[model samples]
Target: MSTILTYHYVGDAPADAGSHKSLFVPKHEFESQLRAIKKMGLETVSPEEFHAGLLAKDLKRKVWLTFDDGRLDNYELAFPLLKEAGLKATFFIIADHSLGCEPGYITVPMMKEMLAAGMSIGSHTLTHPHLARIPAEQLAREVAASKQQLEDALGVAVTSFCYPYGNFNAAVQEEVRAAGYLLATATIRDNRNCDADRWQLRRAMVTPGKSRSRFRYMFSSLYHWLHEWKNRKRWKPREEA
Candidate 1:
């Protein structure tokens, strides 16, 4: 099985980040988590390798590192550490945020630099709207236009899509597929076993203030088993008296 981990901001969350400040993972903590992944013998896969692994069902001891929202801190803080660790990650860009109109998010130049350093890019929608609640026309534009914008700007064929805020439904997913994306990731937390759906591929979010031990547990088969069990129990039907 393969694990997909999600991250957002790196280092301290700036005051402008507002309520989303809780998403910040300190640089030290992030570095320790990366080291723990290495210590546990989990190898980070490139986007192409992850896609191929999903198709072949050959993922074992593999992990895919992903960062969402195209934050500049990701470029300033996380990029160096990843390079130093000899690792690669996919940064899901909010296409509109990279157009220089946004203040805190990454720009197209920064993304290109990271890509040149062996990182990958994916689409995170045009405006990061709630995909499940949007109208059909808006949903279609959010999925298809973002891919076109990112690819046009980055000069690469973007094939992966990440649901903004992990909000997606069947219609939203179909729009993504119809847009020609190969895979999509959701907010669900679990390892990608052979039977895992590529459209809703599970990802465990790496939040702030997580301990080294806790981070280690995130990669454990036992943790995944317990997580799955809890989810099943939560949704399971109550027995009749």
Candidate 2:
């Protein structure tokens, strides 16, 4: 079994950011979390590797680190830590939010630097809309167009899709598949076992503040068991493989 962790931002709050700043973690905390994860021997894999591992049932002690929205903090803060740790991760980027258009979003150069450093990139949709609430046509456009845009911009195949707000249904899942995405991730906090669905892969959200012990226990077998037990009834199992 393997756990996939989700992060939004990793930097100090801006003065004007207000309550929206809750999504960020201080740079030190982020580094500490990565160190704790690495100390536990949880290897981080790209989305493609994760998919292959799931199919081969060879994901023991492996974990996938994912960041949502193409934030500059990912390039400035997290990328160096990951490189220093000898780890790789998939960044789910909003194509529209990238480059010089959006303030605080990473530019194309930064993305290229990350790719050169061995990081993978994925699509977080064109505008980051809620996939479940949108119309079918709009949903298809969001899923398909974003992949095309990211591939065009980054000059690499963007095979992963992350559901904005973790809102997706069967139809949304199929839309992602039809969009040519090899994997899709949701905010379900549990280890993805052998029976994991490639399109609806689950992930645990990383809060800003947590002790090293809590971070260590996150990858513990007992913690995963407790998480499964608590969320089992609330989460429907994936379709049989």
Candidate 3:
């Protein structure tokens, strides 16, 4: 089965870190994780590659790397490391937070640079709001408008959509499909199998500073199946931003 890993921040922690500190993955640890991914012989593919391969059933132990929030550190830190390792990743950007609107989010120029460097870009929505609890009209606007905004800004078709905070439902999934996204990702609520659902792709989160054994376990069938069983009866779409 192919596995996709999701990440958030990729940089050193600030001296005066706040609640978001746990989201920050140190530069050294991030590099180590990449090396481990390589050592496992899992090729890092883009969303398009995964989609095509999924349809063709031609992938073997393939993996896709993804970053959420479009943090500037992804450009300043993860970009160089990924480039150096000859690997690629997809970044999910919040449309309204592009450029100067957000303090730490990646800017327009950085996104263009990432695209130029062969990385994939996707929509995380216009304002990163929770979709499961929003009004139908607002949900439609967030799913559709974010894709349009990113395509207009980057001049590329944004084919992937990740639910903000991994929040979504049947209606939200349909909206994402209606928005024209070929693939999407949700954290902790999905499996490694690509045949599950196109619009509600499952991804495992990769936190920094974990042992090699832990990382290996994350990609194992046991972990995936166990997580599935654990969440099956209690399954509910996330509702937080």
Encode model 3's per-residue lDDT on 1-241: one tens digit a residue. 6678888999877878787777788888889888988898888888899998788876677888899999889999999999988889999999999833588889988899988988999999998998998999999999999898888877999999999988888899899988889898887544366556677677778766778798778788887888788666555433222
Residue-level lDDT of model 2, residues 139-196, one tens digit each, is 9998998899778888989999998987788899989988888999887777655544
Error of 2 at 188 (Å): 1.2
lDDT of each: 0.85, 0.83, 0.84
- List where candidate 1 sits over 4 angstroms from the true fold: 14-19, 233-241
The ten-residue window of minimal lDDT in model 1 covers 232-241
Please give each candidate's TM-score: 0.92, 0.91, 0.92
lDDT of 2: 0.83
Enumerate clash totals for all models, in the order shown.
0, 0, 0
Q: Name the lDDT value of residue 3 in candidate 1.
A: 86
Candidate 2, RMSD to the unseen true structure: 2.9
